[model samples]
Target: MIAKKILNDTFLIRNAKVEDAIQMEYVQSRCYPTLHESEILDRNHFANHIKVFPEGQIVVEKDGIIVASASSFRCDFPEHDSTFLEETDNLWITNVQIPNGDWMYGIDMGVLPEYRGLGLSKEMYKARNEVCAALGLKGQIIAGMTIGYGKVKDQMTIEEYCKKVMNNEIIDPTITPQRSAGFRWIRPLYNYINDPESGFGSILMYKPVDENYYL
Candidate 1:
């Protein structure tokens, strides 16, 4: 796909390259400071993701520097819920990708802290949706990070926090924007990752490429 310009040509969103792994790592580090090291995708993992599913990975560049990225892979809807590690095959998804799966599982998507508020994440999500449509997949599914939960964990239960976020009673740094991008919350996932900021909880969400999507 050709690079699409946005923000008055300040940013270009396009498919990711193996060479972008190092830069992607930089973005990842800056985007998820509270996340554990093991949970973060390393350079090797990024390279393997592009090799295994280039179409499912994309990056946003600014004058040739990658500032954001999203990684995904095709898979059938899971019969049982699983933690992020088990679901992502411990972040080495080479064996987790299904060649003809019905859904696009969004593994990671983040923009550099400095690039936040520019709507780069939304553009990345749109690109992923286009890939889903092109591949005739059902839609996209993700274990969304509740980046704002940690700060308020002492005041409310995970369920209460998520419910408030859903009802617009509160704004989550991650979930709020994802909701705006059209992802519907499916359920809550506990111990989703080693994320203290999220109180180790996450929300299962989905965005259908087609409005009439059904199981």
Candidate 2:
């Protein structure tokens, strides 16, 4: 996709282009540490994922260089699950994660070091919502981060996990244009919260898009 500059802008979140690979790699490297490269992701993997699944990967550029990226894609798995990469359905999706259901999925929200706190990440969500609505999708979803049960347990008693998941350190799905667009919020309690395989601070939230929010 050709990059469209936004309003003589300070930032532009546009469709991903083949040419943006280098800058995209640069951002991914900076946002994550070396240790994260094993469990999380690295630059080459990121570029290849976008090339293979362009539906949801987008870049936020300053001038001609990409400084951030956001992923939002659709699938038929049903319910909100973030580790869709764990799916054994298709060979093509082996490396890349494929979220379940006919929904707008968020792989992640990344920004360059200097680009943090500029609301560029949020703008990237707005952009994702726009695409979801246009595509006639029912909802938007993301595997949100949770602060870790161990950390929370440190703050409170074991009995507090349930209440805390809802009242406190939980990932809320309806926190964007998805909320304003009337998408339903679905929070599923999976082993991710208490399992060693799961990363700390990870939960899935889905928001269904309305018929008229962006028409």
- How many backbone clashes does every candidate have? 0, 9
lDDT of 2 at 103: 64
TM-score of 1: 0.95
lDDT of each: 0.88, 0.55
List runs of model 2 lying over 4 Å from the truth: 1-8, 80-84, 87-101, 148-153, 157-162, 168-185, 188-199, 211-215
Error of 2 at 47 (Å): 3.0
Best-fitting candidate, scored by lDDT = 1
lDDT of 1 by residue, 1-215 (tens): 53688878889899989999999989888888888888999888999999998899999999899999999889998777888889988887889999999999999998888888988888888888998989998899988988899889999988799889878899998888898999988888878888898978888889999877644
Off by over 4 Å in 1: none
Q: Write the per-residue lDDT of candidate 2 for residues 1-215, one digit (tens) a residue.
A: 32455535777778876566677767766764422333444455556656666767789877667888865446653443444344212213434444444566565567887877666766776677667766666656665443344445556543354345555455333233333433333564344322332233354555555645331
